[model samples]
Target: MLTFYSEGSRLRQARTELHDGALVTPFECPERLDLVLKQLRQSGLGEIRTPNAYGLAPVQAVHDKDYVTFLANCWTEWVSAGHKGEAIPNIWPARTLRGDRIPRAISGQLGYYALAAETSISEGTFEAAMASKDVALGAVEHTLKTGEPSFGLCRPPGHHAAYDQFGGYCFFNNAAIAAQRALDSGMGRVAILDVDFHHGNGTQQIFYQRDDVLFISLHGDPEVTFPYYSGYADEHGQGQGEGFNVNYPMPPGTSVATWMAALDQALARIHAAKCECLIVSLGVDIFVDDPISEFTFSSEDFTLLGKRLAHAGLPSVFLMEGGYAVEAIGVNVVNVLQGFKQSME
Candidate 1:
């Protein structure tokens, strides 16, 4: 497995995250990538390559132009507006409120583009986001060209970002962008299997209305999870995308056996869809000791998950998503990659 990464990912050093009505240090910090890189090297998984610059075109392919513009200039605007602390949305266009208008004030604009208030924008956030998408794109290119598996160690993970909103510590939808790039590169059909602890709401929304890309996610039940709005079983794709989107929302403390069963179902659906490429929104937060998520997956289970995906026998790209257990993150992620490598042999 070839892994794509960027030192620019360390630029996003936001210090604030809203949790339980109080501001605390963010769980999605730069060290998450550091630890993962360390483990990848120590485990001798494969070559670690720095990603090439793909610029905003790939990002604009999956995200709205205005949203991309907002993310690029948000930090400068917030600072010029003289607001104190990192930029976090204090208000949002809730139910019955006008969401059509883009606000002029930085604060109002933050609310306009934000899906949740947990993520704060700091200096270099835009740069880091750009690099993160580049990493994903690089991995996609590698997989498509070589017909092999690759990993994108994306930081400030992106599954939670929607078409025009940034939240859940994600500024840009990296996995969605990678999938779009794969499609643009002439693949007939692509499937995204999100095994993250949280549902890939942004990736779902990006491809929800298209049949060319099948989106499937297994996550905590939205009723009790962080992103409480989406991720239900019934929120299937709309229009031409009907029957292409699948969600398996399990309860808290879901056993590894049950989770593997869900993976089997998702793999079966992908095989039926005849997808030419596979993208895994790899998140190890399902680990038993993760603080934010509730699941009971052991480190060894990740190896089995990787083996199962390898058996699918499609060109694969694994994009890093949510995982807070900093110490074990590397082990779990590398376990998956190593398992896939061993299985392929």
Candidate 2:
């Protein structure tokens, strides 16, 4: 499988994120991708290349225009505002707060546009996030051209971002963007299978009212997971998208047996939907040792996970999302791909 990655991912590491009522270091760090790359190469996953740049149309397809403009220009505005460190959003529009106006001050706008402080815009964040998105888009392009599976080693993982909002260590929704690209290229029915430890609330929300794309996710149950809103089993699609979006939100301590069972159910639905292609939001954070996550899946389970997906017999594009167990992440990730290859054989 061809792998896509971006060196720009190293540019936007935050010093800390608010977690567990304390300011703690982030679990989704740049070194996670570095380690995954080393493992993929050593494991003979094939060569990886930098992404080719594309126009803003693909990005704009899923994200709001003003949000995209803000992402592109936030750091410049922050710098102009005399900010010295990273510009993390400190306030949010929740409950009775007024979200009616986009604030002129950078601080208020940051809160208005963002969901959490974990994802801050440093001087280089825009470029890094854009580059990461490019990597995913390039991988999607490769899959479209070759009809074979490819992996995008995207960092600053993007399943939490919405069309007009950013949070959960994400600024741009790369996986959603890739799905939109697939839809644009004549694939009327596409499926997004997110196996991240956390729910892909953003991806689900983007296509919730559309029937052209099918979004399915298997992740930690929202009652006990991060991005603590949405991700419930009852969040079936609405209107034109009814019965299209599926969420297999499992509880904590879920083992491979239960997880794959959920995967099988999701595959049944995908098959019923007659999806032409698949986009997997792959996150090794489900590994037992992932510091910030709660799932109990092991390295061997990932291989099993890949085999199950491959057995579904759809063309696939794997987008790297979250994985913090730096040592085992690559092995776990590559194991899924390798297992998929074996299944095909």
Candidate 3:
């Protein structure tokens, strides 16, 4: 299990975020990735390597070009506009609002391109996002070349981002971009299983209307969770993508038993799809102590989840996503990979 990482991920660290109407230190901080790396080294899972630059082309495959450009320039635009703090959205297009119209002002563009205000764009945001994107694509390339599994240590987790909107501390949809690159590289069929506590709304949106990639997520019920739209069980896909998208929305306080049951079902669906490769949006936020999430999974439960995923018998790419329990994140994440490696033996 090769781990792909970048020091550039530290660049997007925002000072604060608007949570519960009060500005507080962001839950998605660079320290989270640091802890994970520390654990990977302590465990000696595999060699840590810097990623090859895949550039914006692979990212553009799954994201809107204008949105990418906006991410690249938004920080400078915000600074030039005389804003001294991190750039957070003050407004968003709502019902009856014209979303099709692109705004010229930095303020309107911030609101237009941002899915929510929780993710504040800082100075190194675009740089960090590009680094994360390269990490994911590099893992995909490595997996293709070696026919082995690789882990993408992406920061500012990406499941909450959409094709054109950024949120949930994510700018570029790293997993979606990697899946797209895999398909383009001639992997016949790929299955993206998002085991994040939050539904992969962005990944779902990117592949919702397509059939080549099968997206499955097991997360908190969207009715009460963040990203309050589009994670319901009823959204099974549309048109050519019908029956390809699967969502298992479990209620809060769900136990590991219930979560693993959902994983079994998702794996079954993936196997039925004849998936040639697997992309796991590995999020440890489901841990019982995770600050912003509400699932009761114990650390051992993650090992169990990894064991089940290993049984899927497909080339896998594990991309880091959300997990606010900074203290235990590394242990929990490494538990999954270690368990998977042990199972293979």
Candidate-wise lDDT, in order: 0.93, 0.87, 0.91
- Which residue pairs collide in model 3, if any? none
Q: Hey, what RMSD does candidate 2 come out at?
A: 1.2
Backbone clash total, candidate 1: 0
lDDT assessment of candidate 3 = 0.91
What residue runs in model 1 are displaced by over 4 Å at the alpha carbon? none
Q: What is the C-alpha RMSD of each candidate to the true structure, in Å?
A: 0.7, 1.2, 0.8
Lowest lDDT 10-residue stretch of candidate 3 = 91-100
lDDT, model 3, position 49: 97
Query: Between prediction 2 and prediction 3, which has the larger lDDT?
Result: 3
In candidate 1, position 176 carries an lDDT of 93
lDDT for model 1, please: 0.93
The parts of candidate 2 lying over 4 Å away from their true place are none
Clashing pairs in 2: none
The alpha-carbon deviation from the true structure for residue 293 of candidate 3, after best TM-score superposition, in angstroms, is: 0.4
Better of 1 and 2 by TM-score: 1
Cα displacement (Å) at residue 318, model 1: 0.6
Best by lDDT: 1
lDDT of 3 by residue, 212-287 (tens): 9999999999999988887999998989899999999999999889889889999999999999999999999999
